[model samples]
Structure formats: C-alpha cells, structure tokens
Target: MNAGIPAAARELTDRLGPDAVATSGPLYDRTRRVWNGAVTNRPALVVHARGTADVQAAVRAARDHGLPLSVRGGGHDWLGRGVRDGALVIDLAGMRRVEVDAQAAVATVDGGATAADLIGAASPHGLSAVTGTVGAVGVAGLTLGGGYGLLNGRFGLALDNLLAADVVLADGRAVTADADHEAELFWAIRGGGGNFGVVTSMRHRLHRADPILAGTIFYPLPQAAAVLDRLNEVLSAAPDELTVAIAMLTGPGGAPGLGLLPAWSGDPAPGEAHIDRLRRLGSPAFAKVGPTTYSDLLHANDEQGETIGHHVACRTRSVPHLTPDTVSALVKAAATFTSPLSRVLCGQFHGAAARVPVESTAFGLRRNHIMATIISWWPPGDAEPHQTWADAVSEALARDALPGGYPNGLSPDDTTQIADAYGPNATRLRAAKTRYDPSNTFTATPLP
Candidate 1:
C-alpha cells in the first residue's frame, strides 16, 4: 500500500471511525471509477457515508484538507464526475433509505436511492414518480438534471414532484432547500445539478395511479422515420396521460430495430386508444404492452439484471417541429446503426416535462416533444468507435435544437457546452452560482 494512503486512512479512520471510511485495497478504487471510462478519475479517499451526519463529516473533511469534493450517489454518472484525482469522494451509495407516505402520496428518498428503489417503495402505495429509464441511475442527479421518464408527460418531471431537499452545503452546515426555505436554492435544485450543495435526502410528490399500462414496442429499423412521423402527429393531440419515448437501435442479437418505451398514467381503456397509434405503425419485430405496477415498470426491461458495463452517451435537442428534412436526418443517422455494437435513439420529451414554465426552475427547453438522444454501448475496448458514431449523429441533430442540456446525460467534454442547453436561463444560473457556490468548490459532473 502507498504510504500516503495509509496516512490518509488513519486520519479519516480517527475522525470518522472505522465503519464510516475505507481506504484499504479495492474499496477506494471501486468507488473512484464511474460508468464512463473516457472521463475516469482517481480519488485520494472515499468516505462511505452511512447517513446525513457522515455526509457532513466528509464535506467538512474535504474543506479542511482543501480537497476537491465529488458527491457520488448511484455512481452511474456517464461523465465520470463521481470521482476525481486527489479529491475526497463522498460516496452516498450506503445511505439508501426510502420512506413512503401513502396518505400524503409522497416518497422521501435518501440521496443514494436509485430510480428502481423509489419505484419499489411507491409500488405498495399504488403510486409512482417520474424516474430515469435505467433502474440504477440515482434519483438525486436525475431529478437535479430535470429527470425525463415514461411518466414525465403525465406527472411532470422528477423535480416537478420534488417538494423539498435536505442538503449539506459546501461549508459543512446542514440545511433544507425547498419552496418556503432557501427559495432560490430550491429553484436551483429543481433542475440544477449538485452545484450548490450535497443533497442528503429528497421528498417527492407521487402520482395516485396503480398498475400502469407500460412496456416497449419494437419495430424493424425500416419503420424508424415513418413511426416518428406518426408519433409527432399523434402525440400533438394525445392527452398528457400518455407518455412515450422512441429509440432507434440494434437490439440484443445485432439486429437493427426501432423501439418505443410507452407508459400510460390514465385509465387502461383510454390507454388502449392511445396505444393503438403505435400498434398500427407497422408490423413490429416484437410487441409487449400491459398493465404493470411502477416497480414492475422500473424493473421491466431487466428486473433480474446486475450492474454491468452499461455505458451510454446522449445528445438532446428541443425541436420546433419534426420537419421532413429533420426526419430524413434522423433516418440517415438510424441507417448508420448497421453495427450491432452501437445505435441511435429518438425519445419523445414533452407534455408535463414542458407543461412547467421555463422560468419555473433552472432547467430550460421544457416545451419540445422529440428529445433525440443518440446512444451507443459496447464493451471497454470498443468504446472509441461507439462514442464516435454517437457523437457524429448528435452533431447532425444539433442543427434543429432549441438549446438547453439535460444535466444527467452530459458528457465530460460537454462541460462548456451546457450554456447552449440553458439558452436564456444561463445568465440566471451563473448569477445564482455566484451567490451560492462562489468559489465553485462543488463543481462536479456536467460542470456548470
């Protein structure tokens, strides 16, 4: 072991006690790396915080040591902002706590809780919140970055349901940020990533629907443009209760396919009518749609799957309308998905996501349906070609964008590119940051 690590370990162990810190062997290394390799970092220490008290200690220690602080939730960060060289990464993975209030129709989740965790907690109450499609993605980062999900159109974003947040600021003081308390911080937390403070807990509003009719419908790649064209027409008139995301990709067996992840938050009868628009698109390679709980919906794709090499890079845009030329560009990109290792995705992002006013929070671009995210996935060695392919496609679509980026989906290279995503909201965010986190010590993933 390095002499430096042992010293740091001893110092931390003395302050936080043995159970709260780890610097021996693989433990530190495992927590240092995130989902994205292109932006990997190595931290000097990792504090496996068990609760809010541990989080406060980690923050104070980082400040005292003059170390860069990286607050990690699920560690599913695509930009690898969860860890940094010579920094102190406060790992919240051990603080997962989900509390559901059936009568109040709300769920208070610890920062470490994943989307799957919240979904499971809300299932027994017959309620759900808008969460990321990937089950392992953390609720804190996702909600902070303006979470987009199957229920987004109907119930609003994960942040829209965010009632309050309990956080530990950069100075190590613990406080709550919400509508009535620290109002500006509350606005920032809704869509702003973890720039102001380290959130230890969050309380989210929940929807009252149960056994949501949800699942994906996969079509052959040939129908990519046609289905998107049809989706635009139907979604424009469809009620907010129905939310669907479209993806053009190569499925499990190296086959190019177009898929739709649909979730209905309304009655099953009307859901059938709305779903008919998709069922009639064309003969899908496979179709699976049914009434399922939020827990089932969250785990539907891979309920039994383990955390593996799930790497994805995405580009987002809020288009005015899907033009024929735009559709052509999308089809051209989809055609490039000839390789089984990579693919393009065109997900719908509107309704409740857009229903909120742009000035309501730090998040911008709330009024567009097609949030085209070109994602490519592969094993470690093949990331170069896969990401290159995804980047090329994203660049092509940026021409039709309305500006503003999803904080959670950002790549490390896109750190400076976030301004474009914020559009008019950029000025306000900077001013807020200047007032709150002036020194920018908390600059983490998708650095604003």
Candidate 2:
C-alpha cells in the first residue's frame, strides 16, 4: 500500500474484503500496463468492483474522500483515461455478464463486458449490437462515445441502439436511465460520455445478424486513391444493410497496401457487385470477403493488440466525399508512417447514421460520407516525433466536420477535437455536467 492511502479506500476494503480492493503488487502493475507503459499513472489505490454494490461503495468512498474516480471497463481507452495518477480506479473488468433476451430483442450487459463477450453471446441467437472494432473495448465507454464499426453504417452508432443504462450518480445511488426513466440523464449518457456518472449496466437493442458476410480485402498500394474514390461513390448510393471501412497500412515488409473490411447484414450476394468492382480496380494481394461468423470477424484485428506499447495519438474528421485531394493526402501520408504498425483508416458514415436527424443524439458529424482516423504507434520513450507525427496527421485530416463529436472515435485527451466532436451539443453537455455534477466531482471528458 502507498504511504498516504485515503481512509475511504481503507473503508472500501473493510466492507468488501482484500480481493475487492487492489492495494499493491502484481495487479497494480497490470492496471498500469493497460496504458502500455507510456503514460504515467500512480493511483493511491485501485478498486476492482465485482458488482453494482461494490461500485456503489467505491463511488461513495471516492465522493466522501474527494478523490477523483476513474471508471475502467475494458481498459482500452485511447487516451488512457481508465487509470490516472493518484486516483481511485473503479476497475469494472470483473463484472462482465451478458444476459440476452432474444424474445425481447435486448441485451442486459454489465459495464465490464467487452465487445468480444457481447458478440459471442449475441451471435448464437443471431443477434448483435453496434460496437467498436476492438473486441476488448469496454461496451460502456465505446457506446457512450458514439461507437463505429462494421455495423455502424447499417445500424448507426452503438449508442443509437441503446435501450437503457444503470448509472451510479454522484450521490452514490444507482439509477436506471432510459427513454422513460431518468430521461435527462439518459440523453446525457447517450453521447456525453462518462462525464455525468459511472454506468454499471446497460440495456442494448440487438438485431438479428448471425453468420454475417464479413472480411477484409487487400489491394495493391497503387490502387488506394482509386479505391477510396469509388468507395465514396458506392457508399453514397448504398443501402443501410452494407457497412465498410478502408485501412491504409505499411505491410509487414514495408509494402504499402489498402484493406477494405466490408460487412453485409442482409444477403451476401448483393454485395458481390461492389466487391467485384473493387477487385477489378487492382490486383488483389489477399481477399476474404464471404460468409463468416461474427466472432471470426470480431477477432480479426486481435493481432494489433500486441503492437500497442506506449503513447498512441489518433486524429479524426469527416469529409463530404473522398475527393481526389483527400485520396492523395492519404496516399502521401502513408509514406511518412515510420511504424509498420501505424495506419490511416477510413470508416463510412451513412445509412441509419445519416437518416437520424443530427439533433437526435449528442453525437455530431452526421452528414459526411467518410470518417478518417490517423494513428501513430510506438513504445514509451522520447515524446518528440511521436507527438509531432500524431499532430500533423490529425491536423491535416480534421478539416471537414459536422457539429458534436462522434463520441466513439474521439479520445478524451483531445479537448479541441472534443469541441469538433460535440459541436452545438457541447454547450448542453457542459450544462448537464454543471447540474448533475455541480462540483465537477465526476469530471472525465466533454469538460464543462
């Protein structure tokens, strides 16, 4: 234990026992390593909450002690917000319990469930919800941040499918927030992020999507510009049943390439035309677009997990259409990537995402055809070029945008980007923060 441990943390351990409260030792390092040894975090203590009651105790203790509480679910936060230096981390990784009611078409998921757990549970019933690309990302943070994924264009954001949530307020009482219950808090949680409170459980709208037709298609690097141009054209006229994301990366041997991850919710045959058109643009290096289980596709990107070592910065923005200029910018940027692990990604934002009026949810950037993310990866070391590279890429890409942040895509560290993400809704989020957490006790992001 640390020398200055708070009395509240001690009290929590007294009530829940030692296993519930992680004081010092291996688990603490494990929590720190979640940020990949890059960001520095020395929390006074870490509370591993196993249930709603445990979460309640931790919250009350933190509030009573005036200690900042960081809610950690899957521990995949891009900004490393899950564990802060000298704060109490309410680790929710142990609370992963997924209850799927196929008849009701809803899934009651604990705050700790990862995308992998949710997909695995729902896929058997031929049901799924919109989540992030990474299978290990916390469902709570990802959904509240406007989740984007293969199903995004088809089903809109993960929050768009949110039916209800059980959030522990600043006052230490657990309340269910939904359309008809705690309606205002429900709206705030939809896209406002974790600024208001800690969400312990959620009710998500699930769709019947099993054995989905999904996989990635790789093309020669020379055809990336052409591929993006056509992608914009096809997605503009495409239906909500089809969603796709384009990735530009320097391959294993430094061979630059482009990958298209296409997912079709309906019949897989209809997507044949689009896939074929893409195939004709350039010779394929590898292509696996066909009928597959959702679990298989969910695990496809697991290989990248090993590459996350330290500080990683990502910049995102939306463009009306993939113009020649944008395509050329992406092509040129691919050359500057020093890390083979780095990538420039293009995710489609159409279908149900656009059909919803922009004002319907707190998530912004609705009227664009593409969402571009530039990521820089490296081990912990000097912060010079790492910071420069991330800034340059994000700056060059963040030009076009709609108001309000996309929630799922923006990192907590990007305050300016948060403004871009929230746009008009930014003001309301601040006001909600004031009313709900007037003392700023629950502050995390979407800063007031």
Candidate 3:
C-alpha cells in the first residue's frame, strides 16, 4: 500500500472494498483515459462505481476530502471533462445496464450506458431511442448536453426524449427528476449539461423504428461546393423523416471527398426518391444507400476508426443557412486541411427538433440550423498544426454563423461561445443551477 495515498481514498476503499477504488496502477490508468488523446489529466483517486450507491459514496468521499470531482460514463467527451487532474473521479464504466419495457416503449438506461448499449437493448422490441450518430457516446452526457442525432428530424433530440433521470446530487442525496418531480432540475438537465449532479440512470421514450433507409454517398472533393448547395436546397423542403449529415474528409485511398450520410425513417417507398435526389446532386465516386437497421447506422462511425488514442481538437459553428459564402468557406477549409485525419462535419437540425419552443428547455437554439463541427486530429505528439487548422476554419465561419455554437461541442474555455449558447434561457438556467447546486460542486460543461 502506498503510504502517500489520501486518507479519504482509504476510507472509500474500506466502505466499497478494494476492487472499487484505485489510487494507482493499471486500473487507474484505464479509468482515467478519455476519448481525446490530447487530455492527459491523472486523477489521484478513481472509484469504479458499480451502482448508484457506489456513485453516492464516491461523491460524498470527494466532498469530505475537499477534492475536485468528475464522473466518467462513456468518456468520449472531446474536451475530456470527465477526468480532471488531481481530482477524485467516479468511474461509471462498470454500471452500464439497460432495461427496456416493450409495452411502454421506454428504456431505463444506466448512466454509463452508451448509445450502442441502449440501441442494442431496444432493437429487439422494434423500437429505437433518439441517439447521436456515434455509438460509443455516453447516453447521460449526450442527453444532458443536447443530443443531436439522425432521428432528430422525426423524434427530436435525445434530451427531448428523456422522460426522467436518477441523479446523485452534490450533497449526496439521490433523487428522481421528471416532469412532475424536481421539475426545474428536469428542465435544466434537458440541455443544461452536467453542471448539477451525476445522473445514475435515465429513462428515454422510444419510437417504433426498426428498418431505416440510410447510407453514405461520396463525391470527389472538387464537387464539395456544389454538393453543399444542393444539400441546402433539398433540405429546405425535406420531410420530417429525412436527416442528412455532410462531411468533407479524406477517404481510404488517400483522396479527399465530400460525403453525404442520409437517414430516412419513413416508409421505404418514399425514402428511395429522397435518396435519389442526393445521388443526382453530384457524380458519386462511391455510393451505398439501402435498407438497414438503425443500430448498424449508429455503429458506422465507430467502424470507420473514430476510436480513442488520437490527439484531436474540435470547433463548432451554428449556421442558420448554408449560403454561398458559408459553402465557399467550408470548401476552402476542407481543401486546406492540415492533417489527413482532419475533417469538417455538418449536421442539419430541423423538423421535430426545430419545432420545440426555445424556452421549453435549457437548450438555446431551437430554430432550423446547421451545426458545423470542425475536427482536426493527428498522431500523438503532433497537435499544433491540426489545432491551428481547426481554429482558422472556425474563425472563417464566424461571420456567417449564429451568435453561439452548440453547447455540446463548445469547450469550457470558450467563454464567448458559452455565454451565448443558452440565449434567452441563460438567466433561468443559472437560477436552477443555484437552487440545485449552490456550491457548484459539479461542473462538467461550463454553464452560462
């Protein structure tokens, strides 16, 4: 035993057993690792929580010891807010349990459960939850920070589908928040990020969606500008069941390309026409569009090598429309990418997601818009050039973008963007924060 270990950590181990707490060694190393390789923070103590009680114990221990605290679910945050240097981290990776009620069309997912976990659990029931495109993203983190995904066109955001949540507060009190109970907390958590408490479990409403028409169509990089313009035109009158994501990335053959990933949740007959419009937009170098399961679509990005262990920097801009100027900027940025691993992705927010009232939840933007995610990645030990490229692209897009970016994609240090993320709901969100966590013991995404 290391004599230098803190007394609080020792006490936690005594309460939860030796297997639950790790001060050093391989377990600590594994628990502390996040998706962004750039973040190298080392927590002094990591508690592998197996249940809500374990999370409560960890939270109380951190409070008693005056240690900074963080919670790790899927640990896919680009900014790596789940593990902080010298903090005591509650590792929820061991608690991923998902339960589905076919009759009710609802799923109760443990906080650590990823999108993949929930989707796999619900697929057998012919249902699907509104989840982000990536399978590995944590359900709790994504919902709290405003989840934007393929189903948003028809079902709204993941946060909007959240029916209730079980949270462990800063004071060590466990409570269930829903529309009727802890109403303010419920509203805040909808889009407020994890600034109030550690969610132990979440109940999400599911939709009947088994087979979805979806796939990607890639064109040569030279046609990016024209493709983007056509994309905007198509989406202008798109149906609620249609959602598309555009990406400018280097393909497998070391060639740059513009790819359009479309998901149609409506009947297969009508979906073919919508897909045909996209194919006609440009001469596709590679196209694959057909009937597929939603689970398969969610796993597409993970299969394409979006795994951990790479230095990455991300920037975001919310463009109300993809005008000529915006398209030009995006094409220029993609053409000048510093690293081959770097890419730009644009997710369209419309239909059901845009119909929600802005003040109904803490999420700032409810209008139809394009969330431009500028991502730059490189091999370990080389970050400067990639980060610079991402920043320059963000700067170029600022003039044509909305006042604030997506809260989920914005970094904690982005003060200006953070201030504007909540828009008119900023004051109300702060009030809720004070009421639930006056001491500010939990701070994941920086609140406005």
TM per prediction = 0.93, 0.94, 0.98
lDDT of 2 by residue, 1-448 (tens): 4333558767988999988787679887677566444666777789888899998998888878878788877777666678877778898888999999999989999999999999888888888878877787789888887777888777888889999999988878899988888888888887788878888999999987766777778876787777777777677777788887888887655688888878888766776776666566566788877887767777877655545566676667666777776777777677677666678887888888778776666765567467787777776666678667767766666554443344555665667666667656667777777777787766555452
Residue clash pairs of candidate 2: 42-86, 145-407, 145-408, 146-408, 404-421, 404-422, 404-423, 405-421, 405-422
lDDT of 1 at 37: 51
TM-score, prediction 2: 0.94
In model 3, the clashing pairs are: none
Ranking by TM-score: 3, 2, 1
Model 2 misplaced stretches (Cα beyond 4 Å)? 1-4, 308-310, 401-415
Give the TM-score comparing model 1 with the true structure, all chains together: 0.93
Candidate 3 — worst ten consecutive residues by lDDT sum? 1-10
Q: Could you give me the TM-score of model 3 versus the true structure?
A: 0.98
The whole-model lDDT of each prediction reads 0.75, 0.76, 0.89
In candidate 3, clashing pairs total 0
Candidate 1 lDDT tens digits, 147-210: 8778887788878989999988888888999889989988887777888899999999988877
lDDT of 3 by residue, 406-433 (tens): 8878887789998999989999999999
- lDDT at 48 for candidate 1? 91
